[model samples]
Target: MAGMDEAVAELAAEHGDLDALLAGLADDRWLLPTPAEGWDIRDQVSHLADTNDICVDTITGGPRPLNEEALKFPTPEAFTQSGVDKGRAMTPAAVLDWWRTSAARNRDVLLQKDARDRVPWGLGMSAKMMATARMMETWAHAGDVRGALGMEPSATPRLRGIAFLTLRAVPYALSYAKVEQPAGTLRADLTYNGETWPIGPDDADNVITGDALEFCRLGIRRASRAQTSTLKAQGALAEAALDNLRAFL
Candidate 1:
C-alpha cells in the first residue's frame, strides 16, 4: 500500500499538470493539430476524458461497452480517433469539462485504490500498473499537445514512473514480437541528467542501457530505438524487446 499511495499521488500530480496546461489554452490552440497525426488538442482531451472514466470504472465498477470497444481497436491511432467523430458535436469547453469530470473521478480512485485491484489494461495489469499506464499516457499526450503549441516538455522526476514501467515491461515487450525470450536475467540501465537508474539484475550480462527519457519515449512509441541512438543492447532478446516495445499492444 505504501507503493500504491506513491503511484497514485504521482498519477494525481501529472493529471493536475495536464489540466493546468490545457486550462489556459486559447480557443485557437484547442484546434491545433497535435503530433498524433489527425488529432487536434480537443480530440486528445476527449480521448483522455473518455479513458479517464474507463479507468475509474475499472476500479469502482466496470468499463462501459463503448469504452470496452475502444480498447479493442486494431491500432492505437484507430482507437484514438474512434470517439472523435461523435464527440465533434460537443463544444471544446464541454469536452474539456467532460474530461475534467472523469479526471476528478480518477483522482478519487487513486486515493482509495489497493494493491489487490487490477484493470484490464493492455494485457491485463494490476491497479498500480493501471495508474502507471494512465500517467504515462497522459504525459505522452501532453507532449503531443506541447509539440503542437511549440512548447517544450519540462524534464521532471515524474518521468521516472513511466521509465520504471518501461523497464518492468521487458517480458511484455518480448511477447509482442513473439520473440523467444532467452533464459537468464536481463538488465536495463537508464541514464538521465547524469543519474543512472538501473533495473533488473546488476550481475546480468544481458543488458539494455540508454537515456531514461528515451526509454520512456520508446514505451509510448513516441521515439523509436534508432532515434534514441544512445541505447545499447548486449543480448538478442534485449535488442528484440527494444525494437518492439510499446506501452500498449
Candidate 2:
C-alpha cells in the first residue's frame, strides 16, 4: 500500500548510502574478497549496476526482452559465474560510476511512473514491486560489502516492506533450495519499527525471530547464521530454511 514516491525515495537513499560506502573504499579495499564466491567489492558494485540497467530496460518497455539474459542467470551459481567474468576486467572506479548513473536513471523512471502500473520485469511485477526488488538488491549487496569490509550496517526502517515481502516468498525460496519443512506448523517473528510481523502458523514449534535487517541478511545468505545475534531459529524448520536460501530466484 506504499506510494511510488515513498518507495523510490527509500530505494534511492539506500543507493546513495551504498555509493558512498563504495566511493570511500581504497582501490585495495575494492579488491578484497566478499562473502559472494569469486567476487570482490568491484564485482558487487558492478552486479548492482547491472541490476539497475535491467530494471530500467524493463520499466521503460525498451526493446530488450525480459528473458533469462536480462535476468542474467537462472541459478545463483550461473549468476556468480557471469559476474566474475564481467567484473574481472573492470576498474573499481568505473564500476562505481556505472552504478551511480544506472541507479539514478532507474530512480528517474520510477518517479515518473504510476505506483500501481505493471512493469514487465522477470516474474511479472508491478512498478512498486520493481522498486521493492531494487531495494532488496541494495540491501543484499550491502551485506556483501559489509562482510568483506567487516563493517556493521545500520538497519533502515523503510526496508521493512521488502523484508515482509521476502517473508511471503519464503516458501518459494525454500523450494528453490530444494528443501521442504515439515507440515505441522512454524512461525517466523520479525521485528522492525517496534512492531512484530509473523510469518507462518500461529501454533508452530519453529520460530525465527530477529531484527529486521539481520533477518534480511540471513534470508539472502549474505551473513552466515553464526554471524547474526538478531536471529534465533528453533527446531529443524529454522535450519532447513537457512539451507541454500536466496532472495532472488
Candidate 3:
C-alpha cells in the first residue's frame, strides 16, 4: 500500500501539472466545454474546488457544506447542478484561485493526518486512500479539460496511484455497476513509459494487461473498452472488472 506521504506527493504533482495547463488558457478558452455533460472547463475546476472544501470539512469535523446542501436537493444530480451553477457564476480567475487555494489546503490537511486516519467522502477512507483519490480525480478532470482543448494527455509515473486505486476498488466498481462480484481475484499488469505496474495478488486467476494510461482512462470512464485497443482481459472476473471499472462514485 502507498503511504500517505507518497500519495500526497503524487496529488501535489497532479495539481501542479493541471495548474500549469490552466494558467496558459485564454479567458475565452475557459468557456470551452469539457467531455463532462453540461460542464465547461471552468465548471470542472469549480467542482474540484468545491469538493476539496467539502473534503477538508469532512476531515476536520468542521461545517459540512456538501452534507448541508445535499439536504436541499431532491437528487444527487441536482446537488451537483448547484455546484455547476455556482461555478458558472464566477469569473475564470476567481474559479482558478478558488481551486488553487482549496487544493493546497486539502493537501496540507492530509499531510497532517496519520496514514491510518479515516476520512469521509461519503465513504470512509484511509488518509492514504483519500490522497490517492484526490490525485485520481485531478488526473481524470485534467483529461477532460485537455480533450476539450484538443490536447493529448501526457501520461506519467503518477498514474501508478490511479491504476492501483482502480484495482483496489474492483469490488466497489462491481457493486456500483450492480454486477455480481466474481469469486476469484483480478490482477492488472499495466505499462506506461516503459515501466510496468503490476497490481493485485500474484496468484490471481483473472488478470488484465495493458497500457497504464488506457487502464486509468477506463477506470474513470474516460475511455471505453473499445476505445482502448491496447487493453486485454483474461477470465470472466477480469472482463467484468474492466467493463465496470470506475475511479469514483
Candidate 4:
C-alpha cells in the first residue's frame, strides 16, 4: 500500500503533468471536443476544478457533502452537467486558474490528514485511497485532453497506483453494477515498462493479464473488453470484472 505522503506526491505529479498539457494549448483549442461525448477540453478542466472544491468541502464538513449536493439535482447527469456549465461560463485562463487554486488547496488539506483517516469519497475510503483516486481521476482526464489534441497517451510508473486501485475496487464495482459474485477469486497481473505488477492471491484461478495502462482504462470505463487488444481475462469473475468493473464513482 502507498503511504499518505507518497500518494499525495503522486497526486501532485499527476496534477503537474495535466497542468503542463493545458498550459501549452491555445485558447481556441480549448473548444475542441474530447473522446468523451459532449465534453470539450475546457469542460474537462472545469469538471476537475469543481470536483476539487467538492472534495475539499466533503473533507472539511462544509455546508454540504458531495452525495448530499448531488441529490438536489434531478439526476446524476444533471449534477455533472452543472459543473460543465460552470466551466463554460469562464475563459480558458480563468478555468485554468480555478483548477490550480482548488488543486493546491486540496493537496494542502489532504496532507494535514492521517493516511488511515477515512474521508467522505465515493463509498468512503482512507486518505491514501482518496489521494490515489484523485491521481487516477487527473490522469484519466488528462488522457481526454490528450485525445482531443490528437496525441497518443502513454503509460507511466504512476499507473501502478491506478492498477492497484482497479483491482482493489473490484468488489465495489461489481456491487455497484449489481452483478452476482463469482465463486472464484480474481487476480490482476499487469505489465508496464517491462515490470509485472500483480494483485491478488498466488493461487487464484481467475486472472486478468494485460498492459497496466489498458487495465486502468478498463477500470475507469474508458475502454471496454472488446476495445483492448493486449488484455485477456480468464475464468468467470475475471471476465465479468473486465467488462463491468469501474474504479471511479
Candidate 1 per-residue lDDT, tens place, 95-142, comes to 888988888788677667675565665567787877888888789888
What's the true lDDT of residue 205 in model 3? Answer: 98
Name the candidate that leads on lDDT: 4
On TM-score, the stronger of 3 and 4 is: 4
Mind sharing the TM-score for model 3?
0.94
In order, the Cα lDDT scores of the candidates are: 0.78, 0.75, 0.87, 0.89
| All candidates in order of TM-score, best leading | 4, 3, 1, 2
Please give the distance, in angstroms, between residue 219's alpha carbon in candidate 3 and its true position after superposition: 0.6
What lDDT is reached at residue 243 by model 1? Answer: 86
lDDT of 3 by residue, 108-202 (tens): 99998988887766556788888999999899998889988998976989888899989988888999889998779888999888877889998
Candidate number that wins on lDDT, 2 or 3:
3
Worst 10 residues of 3 by lDDT: 62-71
Q: Which wins on lDDT, candidate 3 or candidate 4?
A: 4
Q: Which ranges of candidate 2 are over 4 A from the true structure? A: 63-65, 68-76, 179-188, 193-208, 224-245
Residues 149-198 of candidate 2: C-alpha lDDT, one tens digit per residue: 89776577765766765665667777876777455455778888898877
**Candidate 1, residue 67: lDDT:** 43
- Arranged by lDDT with the best first, the candidates are 4, 3, 1, 2
Q: Looking at candidate 1, what is the lDDT of residue 239?
A: 79
Error of 3 at 189 (Å): 0.6
Task: Output the lDDT of residue 159, model 2.
Answer: 59
